[model samples]
Target chain A: MINRPEPILMKGNEALAEGAIRAGCRFFAGYPITPQNEIPEYMARRMPEVGGVFVQAESEVAAINMVYGAAGAGVRAMTSSSSPGISLKQEGISYLAGAELPAVIANVVRGGPGLGGIQPAQSDYYQATRGGGHGDYRTPVLAPASVQEMYDFAGLAFDIADRYRNPVLILADGALGQMMEPVLLDATPREVLNVPKPWATTGMKDRAQNLINSIYLDPDELEQHNLNIQKKYRRIEQQEVRYEIILGDDADFFLVAYGTTARVCKDVALKARAKGMRVGLIRPITLWPFPSQVFDDLLEGKGNRQLKGSPKPFGFLTVEMSFGQMVDDVRLSVNGRAPVYFYGRTGGIVPSPREVLAEVEKIYAGGAGKPEKAGN
Target chain B: MTYEMLFAGFGGQGIMLMGTLLAYAGMIEGKKVSWIPSYGPEMRGGTANCSVVVSDEDVGCPIVTEPSVLVVMNEPSLQKFYNTVARPGNVFVNTSIIDPHHPALARLVGENGERKSQKEKGGGRAVMSENVSATEDESVIAGEGVRVFKIDANRIAQDLGNGRAANMVMLGTIREVTNVVEMASLESALQKAISKRHRDLMEINLKALHTGAEWVRSHDVPLLTPAG
Candidate 1:
């Protein structure tokens, strides 16, 4: 019997560790960095307790390569780091993505325009959502708003990685990494994950030789590989889109945000309603699959019938800490169905509730007059 | 009612422990609770702070901008957090090495709606005591509304066989004054929250908490009535 408590206080990194362990992650390899050190620390202690393998590699680059090795073995593997450290691991990540290996990589981001302060920052929004690793490829990103989501999504990340045969990124910030919240800690049983391993490097004795390689010198062969990966991505786009809706039924304006930024939007949505503004929030849980359909459904009207001259009462406002990363995705999702707007605070500064409320007031008071360009 | 607090001090002063204990106590009482500590470079020696939120309903945002209560163990922490306290809130100050005149001093208002400057009350350069003492005599005379409880957390911790446990003592005092959680529940939570390696130190810390609570009770520390 699994005894699950309602809520238990936990740091975001610690929660991630628990979630990864429960998700049948048997191997973790990573070097330690500030703001995300707890993840590796927790994994080091807990992995052994669960009869798993935990290796603190010499560097982030080596750790990511180790993840590459483990993932080739068709075992659930993971690694974590800050922005600078993540920068170093980009090469390995690109290789993993190319190889079509399932693995989880957590970027508990801190400030960085080249090793900026260790304070929490959303500067990595562009890197995470836009694919930091070198490739004409994309990785599914999950942004968790609270510690509980941190725990829940870590497990989900591993599952999605395996199902899609792609590297999954948990794009969390220092605030989430350092922050602790009550989280129900129930280990998802290992038997629940019936992972198939036709390609695993588990020694080919009674089976065909398994090959896990990203390099394909023949142009046609590489093209075929790319085609297969693109098809998988397309399927992912069709089937996997996750988001949280807050008071959307009566909303005239929709606030779009993710991760810690979404939490602030939730507060503003409440205050705006109290002040008689019909505002709501669409918090994207999965950033890569982008929840484009949700945006389309909201803007184009749910059913086939359009409300005559109602003109889609909802206007999409993208709120992020970066200047305009997620806003581009929101615009693409809306695809001219409705006007898309944006509000952001850069360089490690989080907007206050009052600031967000003021933005809502401005938007309501003839501020969203000019339609924002598609990719701004 | 929801109460959010930020306890800040030097790295070794038990600031994080204080916030954890409050969170544990809130959990024991079935209230939603969160404790987020400072991580990375800022946590080494520069400064350390932790945010603790206890609420009746689900806590939407754990990051606190205007905390109802602020606890400072040093001058830097006092300067850093004083402006973030909500008006009509309480602040606890540790006045051992921190002279009230240190440029990072916090502004406190007494009961009579007048600002009681710490420097003026502490006589510009009051001899820094090894024990915690309230230098806010001017606030008492002026009747400013803000409550400032000063304590020598170091002295309390030493008496408890570990100066680091002063944070727990301060948490006990805050609980007693605020009635945020029951004293027994807080102590039990504290026992569970502390690592097993430090299980032997739990009794002394609990004793320290009780001592601090008794002090608050005996002194009749005025509680901040909840905001309407």
Candidate 2:
């Protein structure tokens, strides 16, 4: 366990690496990529000190495959990359999912479609939450907004991955990756929850030969595997959805955002409140499960009984760093209960707090929650 | 209290280092802080910038679009970011290379109230005075309220026998002006921020910081003739 009780300055990438090592990750393999090169650079020096193995693979595909091998051996392993590099690892991710290997991957995303600029963007939300890999599978994606969350979620991602025996992702952006912040490392040694991997292909010395394979040629067998994976995903969707609602209970409008964009929206929420508008923020910490239940409860006023009969109609403004991606999830969750609006900037352009506050003002003046024009 | 700062200069001017030191010093003082840099292609001798936020509360956006304090080490940086400084903000300019007559620097009228008495007692170098009025094309937008402090940061560092310590000098000046972090905290942060290979430069860096802080504290004393 890392033991710096006082807050220490650390880059998010360095904090993530340290947290993973503290979480008992024994192996890390990653290729260098923009905005995230610090992860591999950090791991190269720190991993050896902790008796963990670190490899700078030839390519992203090779790096992921190394993680696959390490995970197959029942060791906690992880790989990290940026957008284009993450694209190269999709096939390996799919294989890891199909084989039910517990491994963590971090995507410190840059703008994308092709080799987009090495600036922050939320465009990879669909790719991460929807499982960029092939077939009908899901990866639990944890979107961390702060450097502290980047550290804390590294352990959470590994725990979740091990519990489900599936690939888990930490979805971050270049801004979060490159930013430095004060984070409190645990003062006391954390109790690392040692998960027993009974199905691991460790050696069949006395037990029956453990087979780790993803290929199921028979139609019935493949369907059953798919169904079982879906069942696990459903369990995760119910139990593992993490979200945060800030100043939301007594509000008339909500801003839905995650990761880097969420932090900007939070400032906007405070500013809007200061300006006499009741604005709240819904930040989804876990992007995969999408925290739709919170949206439902807030939209229908199910949780806040006092607001049930209130005359004011509440609205949701989904903010993202993408052209529009997570907005779809917000719409799906809102599902016509409340009018959903969106404001976003694409191609690595982060929205200023002023810009978001202006949007909130426009929405507030236009009489929020009405069935209105589609957002830009 | 929250102070959002932007530091911009050429790639090797230690722009990122200035941000890092402030962030680390703030953290040491038990303040929440964040630093984010302009990475990738921009580092190739072009303008490199970093945003740093120090707050009693959690920092919301690490990117500083409306900087409460702006430190520009080059003319290009001052030209590019002069308008982005919030009203009633603080601006620290490295005047060694930049023209002292730049119109955006019209706000460098006098010393801040807190340091004015110190300036009287110390009898140090004089700051720029407002003789010529600013023209419309190059003046700062909504910049009348900003308190501009100009120091020849590179020259000060060079005087200390290391030109690279300009960032440390600037850091000292910022600490003196903003008091965002303690000088002791900055000293300790310097020990941590400097790597082992560069340990020898620590004393010079600290000296540069002290020199800078000294310059700002007594800059209005008119020991040296004011730049025209």
Candidate 3:
């Protein structure tokens, strides 16, 4: 039996890189950018050591395209960047979604509308959750709050992506990327992965030529392809919604957040409880699936029935680092069963625990505004 | 309970290393721990700071804006972090370089004292500085209101043959004062956490740590109290 190694201190970016390697990621391509340079720098040194290929692409666009090429071969491949660079990779991501290829992408997000400060931010919430690139297709997104999550979810991302044949994104921030924590690598042994690629372009053999094409010229064919992709996504939604519920035993109000925002929300929950409030947290590990059913179940008094008859139990509050991007999803999940409120801090600024608690109080007092209906 | 600390200094002062060692010791003690370093632009020549959190329960927000303790190695670091420290929090200063009556602490006192409505009847205690003259003359009066402990970490590190070992020395002092970890466990953690390439330097670091701990114990400074 392989014993788990003792916990070692590691940065989030380094954990992501290690997770990729253990998840059978044999190909990596990336361009260096602030707050995310460590990912590429680490891969440059480590990939070769692990008998893998690491390429320093000229630009973010090129790096993502390289990821596209490697993913088409049905191999575990990845590329990473910050917000501005992620914007450059949007086209390639959309293409990967169109092609229905499996790959991993990491965005160690920084503050941004454009060329913003190099600090941790969740400003890309809308971009990641609503499909930043031009398409109706959605990629699986994983938001990790801690360095250990950075490692755990990175491996989970690869598996989920391959299982669905869809691109998976590790949505982190500068703080998560730069922070170091003791990570335990003992839960599961490194999975030995072999993605069979009969359709790969590793030079046509004696078998029938396999053509990997995203371009379906015929309108009917394109629609059929879209329908097929939708079917896969529907299957994923049915199977792969992951989240963590904290202190929900007697919770009357639920705080919905993800990534670094969730970490802060947890602290606020503690403070709220101390002040005689029944606040709990629902942290979605998977963003694309959105954990809608979990929210529905909780709101309908299915999960945590102890919270059922609380007199002052409010609805759910969606907290993020962006301006109400994830609030729409929270509203969609609740489907008007209970009030859905939003609180946010943008431009890479994180909300303090006091600010989050203040919002919770506002919602509890029936003062928070009703969530604007989404166009879905 | 959780103890959050910020170690601030110039880049070469091993502030980050000091935080890392504390975090390592916490890990050895089986507590949840996190160590976050300042990287990129602010780490070049400007003040560098790192936050370390150790808790029996799960750690919530690892980015500590108001730390329970501040370990400052330079005047700039002290200036940058003096105001953000929690009230009743300890501030460890390297008094060999920084003046006890630095302008930053004066500003902090002006703001905090006025805002908190502290009475001005008693003279405020200044941050303790090592009295070079007192070392020879032994007659100077030191104030007691503000808690401060003075140590010459550089001299100790130089005597240990590696100036960077000053970080470990500080770690030893923190361990002794805070009781976050025992000295033996910290030494073992240092041995395990450091890279194999630095194995040979372990003995020197061990010696420096003991020396620093002995310095703190021998000084009979009442300010070096345990973090309650």
lDDT tens readout by residue for model 3, A140-253: 889999999998888889988887778888999988998889888755668655556666677777988777778999999999999999999889888888888888777888
- Candidates in order have lDDT scores of 0.78, 0.85, 0.78
Clashing residue pairs, candidate 2? none
Error of 2 at A74 (Å): 0.7
The weakest ten consecutive residues by lDDT in model 2 chain A span A304-313
True contacts kept of each: 0.68, 0.84, 0.66
Interface RMSD of each: 1.9, 0.8, 1.3
Best by DockQ: 2
lDDT of 1 by residue, A1-376 (tens): 2446556777899999988988889999999888899999999889998899999999999999999999999889999999899999899989998999999999987777898767676778777776688876778899998888898899889988988889999999888888887788774353435668688899979988888889999999999988998898888888777888877776778899888888889888888999998787889888888888766666667652222223355577788777778888888888877778788876667777777778778778866557574222
Once model 3 is optimally superposed onto the true structure by TM-score, how far is the C-alpha of residue A134 displaced, in angstroms? 1.8
State the lDDT of candidate 2 residue by residue for A1-376, as single tens digits. Answer: 3586888778899999988988989899999988899999999998899899999999999999999999999999999999999999999999999999999999999988899899998899999988898999999999999999999999999999999999999999999999999888878765577889989888788898888889999999999999999999999999999988787757788898999999999999999999999888889999998888876676555754534543334688889988778888988988888778888898899999998898899887884444445455
lDDT of 2 at B148: 70
Tens-digit lDDT track of model 1 for B1-228? 878788898998888888888888898889888787766467777778988889897676677788878888887788777767775567777765466433333234422212234334554422222111233332111012356676666787788787767777788778876788899888878878889998888888888898778757666344454333
lDDT of 2 at B100: 60
Q: What is the interface RMSD of candidate 1, in Å?
A: 1.9
Give the alpha carbon lDDT tens digit for every residue of B1-228 in model 2.
899999999988889988998899888888889999988696787789999999998899999998979999998899889888875577888888787656667534332232335546653433212232122222121224566766778888998999888888888988987788999999999899999999999999999989988876764321212323
Candidate 3 wrong stretches, greater than 4 Å: A1-4, A186-189, A193-195, A303-312, A362-376, B103-146, B156-164, B193-201, B219-228
Which sections of candidate 1 miss by over 4 Å? A1-6, A187-191, A303-311, A367-376, B96-106, B110-145, B152-165, B220-228
